[model samples]
Target: MSDADYFKNMPHDKNDPNPFLAIYMDQSIPFNEEAKAAYLKDCSSRSRQFLLPVLRPFARLMIIVLQLYKIIVPKALTSSRLLHRVLHFGMKTFVSPSANFMILRHFYLGSEVLGFIRDNVPGVHIEMNPLKPTKLEPVKDDLFLIHDLNLYNFVINLNRELREKGTEVTAQKQLNFSSITSSRIPIEQMPRRWTNFMDLTTAIECFTPVYQLFLTDNDFWRATNSLQLDETIGILASKIIGSNDRLALINNKHPMVPLTTLKAGFRLVLHGLATEQLHALLVELKLKQQKEAAISS
Candidate 1:
């Protein structure tokens, strides 16, 4: 069998769940107007009552102060690893768990979509590949949906380039032709946002290349310190690839979960906070909640 055929026919591990796999299959299906309306309504109700509206401004201010401090303070004084750890600890200790949950709730839909895909779609699996060396060390596992031709093309091209340059390429690096599904489309034709979930799956997949570029671009890293690049890229790419046919990967015509002016402003503020800091705070809050539950039980 040819190389592509092998990947297409590769055995799928039944236990693994991949959220993006659902996104891949979702493309072939028609848009569900009722489901979209229900999701938006649920989001609206949650946003209206959450403390996110009130705390967003304060979070924005804190982030600004932190960034300014990093810029103005000498690297020698600010480089203390211990001091950074302590500050992170303090933030984790004080930040309210509810605040973290409210902010992260927007992403929960992805997990829910993955669960649905696992139950409904047979033979779906998540494949991980090591990224090239960049600012981030040791490389990390990038999650990809098996049977996704678009993703397979990306992996195949990336690995081919790496191999030509004498970089060690493993079996995982090559496209599993056996796993390749006919539903896959060209990278440029990939949808940025899914109508069913209103999630930015395609945009996110497109971002893998952009992120790889950023990691290797020394000048960009030095200037921005890679701060808020995730949000920055998402917003810019979404606008540049406007919702349309041909090159347009996203269909903006679908009913989207409304992010009111205030909510958008709040998200902007939240974006200012370092991603790692927010993650740390969320982890700490989860631990605290687990302990509380244990005590109650």
Candidate 2:
């Protein structure tokens, strides 16, 4: 079934044998005994077939690398004000706008979910804090678990409404050279100021979680590195440093690049911990099924 159809047909009843409900839904109400038993059995089979073997070694390697980095890097340098400033500036100047835009989209979707829950769900208090450019925190409460699921539902419903009114979004036109030149003129004319520095720091702070999430996804990592990630890094460095000669001097030798790469790797390790947690829950469910099956047989 298509993804939209799958989500649309998701069973609301607790007794329904949908595995996604177990993982994605709030489980305040217990499922019927028979349905729970069947779900447990399904979890066991799926875990053994699809989850454990692939994830176990990946998790182990991730932990080892993170531990080693902690041992090798001094806390003082890691926390240096100048170093952080440089890193922030480098990231802002070098990272593609596409990445920044995608992260912003996630924040937007999250805000929409918060609003929906607040207006619709009775007795569930939702926090309405503004999205900080720095420091993206989790929702204050469990009122919006399964953010992606909720965002998908929100978008689908919105599109349906728009379609019923015979309205469709138009495609964006390509930007011309004149438009691009005009956009850069303002920044070129402006003098470097403290607020610019503050904005850079704030952007870094807000982007940390988005970067972590992006790095943790194995597919994204693979796709990013497929064309030699260092090559693009080199180009960005050349532009910032104003010479290919300086680029060669630093090149792949810069500590910032390695440090950022390591940070991303470490974040992936943390992601592995989350995966392990889910795997453990599935294993427990599987064992429960086995015990019940033995009792029945």
Candidate 3:
């Protein structure tokens, strides 16, 4: 999106001194008190004036409620420490607050699986093909939802682990891929639902943060890092996704490619670069979070 569009759509106060608004209104009307009064009187004379005036005020109230909810709610509500405002938008539509905690726990399992994928999976990159972007449109929504939850779980787990280990006091404020990735354990072998659909690592990457959240100590992490990929996938399948009755039905009825295979396919098709890209993505994510934090503070 263009910067102009982004700022224009952004929520702002009636009294906001935003430069974007200044530019938008420049030469059209003066923004002083007298101009505002005349503008209101003119608007009052227009048809649908009452309805139109109410719309902007109502929109502002909604924005306030949303921001307030973001500040009041816990991060686990949507499996994210960042983007709670946006994520909560989804919940307001699709999810019930009563079930938020259960969903959050499921997300944690997914995060741990993602952790394994980062360290061990063969190099496969996500090349955003402009021409072919629409080809895989069907599964993209589900995949994105899965990734969003995983990232949330990862932040929560990482923050907790860093706090417990006394590794660094500012760990919550920074990203540490090495520390997190190095702690991954191999998947435990068991009845697995994901074997047919995803590469073990790729599937795990989809949801490892959720799994990592419940971990006890360094010993558990050490043990997990050693498990075979298949075994770990199976463990996750049975304990997390497979256990959910609604999701289990979807898995059993319509098994797509295995998560392991999907990873390889994504890498081959997309042809991604190294972890350096991750650095950029992480920086953007953090900056957005910091901005939100500042707004809330």
Candidate 4:
């Protein structure tokens, strides 16, 4: 019987039931899930599933809303300072640090995933060169990155190319994020603001049992890493960064399906200015490195 005809899943190879142990055995995973949820063992509630025909008007209204709003939404990043700061508080409080970190990590992970496809596939596969990883040097107040992690990552990518050729920079650098964003949103307000930034850990430990009543870490990770996910966000980064640096291997893919909503467009804008400022910082570093080399020689 075809898999399409019924719910079907393959049997796990008992001899190698846990294959991830082999795949990542030598490498340190950049993110770790610390929570042990008994909920994952519980069977899903198979409640009656039926789409209500009564909600047709509500669905139609949403379509109309999308049609009206999509026309005015900006397709790329914005330069407005006020808008960045205004959205700062809400995004900081409601969004998990782990979500922000993984999304930031997506900039690299997506590129790597696509690259593996290109090298492995023989027929008309496109090249996907991984972006150079920017190793942040130890600095005071580094935790401020949790304030606007997307912008922080955007800047890192913006400077990566220039840093690659200009000088033999030590694989360490301090980011003065204030130079990029002067927002007075105190870093203290961000959860776990004092935690070590360099550690390869996740904020999954922070979710409380009360919060997990509806959706546990298992649901969150599965959703966050896949659909309802950043594959779309990856699409945005690919477009902004360069034509060659795109993440989606699937043709005709967009960050938003059917429509790009106003809120989604605003995210692109948030990454704009700080990305610009971070570029300037790297440019200055290149010049400084050259000047020091000249003086010593």
Question: lDDT per prediction?
Answer: 0.29, 0.33, 0.31, 0.29
The candidate maximizing lDDT is: 2
Measured against the true structure, the TM-scores of the candidates, in listed sequence, are: 0.26, 0.24, 0.19, 0.25
TM-score of 3: 0.19
Off by over 4 Å in 3: 1-18, 21-140, 143-148, 169-297
lDDT of 2 at 275: 23
Query: Residue-wise lDDT of candidate 3 within 70-174, one digit each (tens)?
Result: 455523234323333333433333332212222332233234334532332223221211111111222223433444334434434544554666642211232
Alpha carbon lDDT at 251, candidate 3: 16
lDDT for model 4: 0.29
What's the best-to-worst order under TM-score?
1, 4, 2, 3
* Model 3, position 181: C-alpha lDDT score: 22
> Best candidate per TM-score, number?
1
Instruction: Compare candidates 2 and 3 on lDDT and give the better one.
Output: 2
Which has the better lDDT: candidate 1, or candidate 2? 2
Model 1 deviation from native, Cα RMSD in Å: 20.2
Poorest stretch of ten by lDDT in candidate 4: 34-43
Off by over 4 Å in 4: 1-94, 122-297
